[model samples]
Target: MGLSSRPRCQLAEQYGPVFTVHLGGQKTVVLTGYQAVREALVGTGQRLADRPPIPIFQLIQGGRGIFFSSGPRWRAARQHAVRTLHGLGVGRAPVADKVLQELRCLVGQLDQFGGRPFPLALLGWAPANITFTLLFGRRFDYQDPLFRSLLGLIDDVMVLLGTPGLQLFNLYPRLGALLRLHRPVLRKIEEVRAILRALLEARPAPAPGGGPVHSYADALRQHGQGGDPDGLFSEENVVACVLDMVMAGTETTAATLQWAVLLMGRHPGVQDRVQEELDRVLGPGRPPRPEDQQALPYTNAVLHEVHRSITLLPHAPRCTAGSTRLGGYLLPEGTPVLPLLSSVLLDKTQWETPGQFNPGHFLDADGRFVQREAFLPFSAGRRVCPGARLAQTELFLLFAGLLQSFRLQPPPGLGPAGLRTVPAPAFTMRPPAQVLCAVPRPRGR
Candidate 1:
């Protein structure tokens, strides 16, 4: 509940700039400024690259996937993940087209509401389906049972990870294990692993000579044949990596989109300006294209402002791989470090009026879109999100497409003053369930 609670910037004032938090008998130095974050994440070499041992990820992933795995195994898997995403058109037109299609579907769904107050119950599904299609070459109907189950399992994992009990367990692993206190958590992890295992086992093997199989599963099956070093590309890695992709790619994008909708509903002038820009640029008949982003500076600024205003994951955990000096403190090998990303986003020195919802933060005097170094929704350095580029493209396309087709507004009598964003508090900082009205705009207006 770091920044998930009301008055989200309280921690920044209380902690000054940097502070220490003790967890699991470890000292985690929290970097609150852009300079400090750069020093810890970018300046330091692999000395700060390793991840701390988390019992849940370790138990389910078995140190196979990119998120939980470390050292050489992590390096190989991450390399493969980046390459596979690129080959599959992650940032390119193919993926953008797929996202556009999904945005069309979302627009249709909104239209069906007919300006009624209907909750977008778990809007994460749209992006989740996109990631699923990209990784597994499959998409589930919105009401599909298996799809709902997968989403539930993912939500459970995120919630469990953020629980105070789990944090305490990370500190006192032996004691928690001695009491069999984490059995329920272990069971949930097993459930997800079992689901992934079944999916992996059901996949058909690649044809002889690797005649170009589709999907990450197929790619892993093909490369896993020769037995990668230490079996890093084995079935286990494939399952874990696929899970990582879905988990990482799905909720974060969806949550950010939720924030966008919420923020727009709160500010009609900002929303009107965005719609005007969309109307002037793309018009109502045509869908948004990636190239059009350059022409839509205000729209792009709003997107950036949304990311800056609401950070998805406030802090990213890192551990020192070797001895390193940070901010005049000598940190030993394996010391835990928490890069306070929200602090950076809300750093007064870097941002003018850091607390307000102002799109001007991303715009220069001439009204050109300018990216700030401190504006990093996706963490920086070696372990930066592999899906950053892909997610950005999707967000832009989907956001633009939706705004172009329909006007998002609050329900009658529930104006901007009534719209409040209560934090849902999980692995990500998501807005709580709320309903908004989507009024269809005059076609081609």
Candidate 2:
């Protein structure tokens, strides 16, 4: 996963971009390359928007929440989430301020290491705290027990979801149920649910005036009180939504940052270039802003390359909402579709150098940042990620702010090549458990 290539490249070349692959008893259509995957997602629109029942998630959410739910329920949950996020200033200056605050917290934590090696997992703390702030209207201290516990549970669930036993259970639910393969995951899930339930219980009722939701919890509360006949905002659904939001909102940006840091540490030349750009644009004393991305083209390209290279949520399988023609093939209703995003990001025809860590892919000869058509890190269509803007803002400030403050590199004894880049097998393509040193940069320019 840490490598710049995907095996699906060969598969697509041999079998064409669109082909059917069997995951145990399930037959899922795999869409590879930019054109094929985009057709299934952007071209087909909502026809491929629904999520098919994956056994583990079905057991966990019961077709509730934004990520896995379908039909009217999913639509309503997603719409409300988008509105709530905007109301809370997710994509605006307010969000940049909040993210910058969290970034300072992260930088402080990293500084405490005093040039000693620290686990890369520490990078995730900032993004997770941002999500927590949105969900609970507050953030947790780095030493808080609840914060550590929630992160531990999330880590456990992510690793468990990618385990072979769970994969088998997802493929053959009834048989795996008899063999008891799902108990571990369910146990971890219950632990997380208990924490969230307590949090929801502790929330004071939404204040009068039906004002815009300040937090995700308040948003769900308002949704339920709107006399929701469909019961979309029931207690259980709210819990599911919160969990989904936390899991989805936190993991992607966190994982991508991990990748960015590692990539920077691995390629010192590239890191030097990015630092130079940061120094030139914002100088040593000023903090990085989201708006700085326009002026700092090299740093911006580096971040975009991070997203393009990792392709975190590669196979976020979608279910055919109805019978439709995709990539010249007819798919029946409910056909599970694997829109292989990794394949698209690394498409030979799309990227100039598909297997190298080059930021020039996002740059033109004029040395300005250029958007590529294949940079669909957030996916597309009706089921597209609602938190895209928030994620970008978080990434921009955190990445820029960190490099602006500290020089990221591997441990003293461990050189760049000594650091392992292969992602630990997890639901998300997160950097493997590794260590890096954040040496404080000089105060004077």
Q: Best-fitting candidate, measured by TM-score?
A: 2
Q: Clashes in each model (backbone N, CA, C under 3 Å)?
A: 1, 0
Once superposed on the true structure, which residue ranges of model 2 sit more than 4 Å away at CA? 1-7
Per-residue CA lDDT of model 1 for 4-107, tens digit only, reads 32233465468655567655566666777788887788889788888877765676677878987789988888888888888888878888888887887677
lDDT of 2 at 133: 91
- Which lDDT value does model 2 have at 279? 84
lDDT of 2 at 242: 98
Candidate 2, residue 356: lDDT? 90
Mind sharing the TM-score for model 2? 0.97
Clashing pairs in 2: none
lDDT of 2 at 174: 95
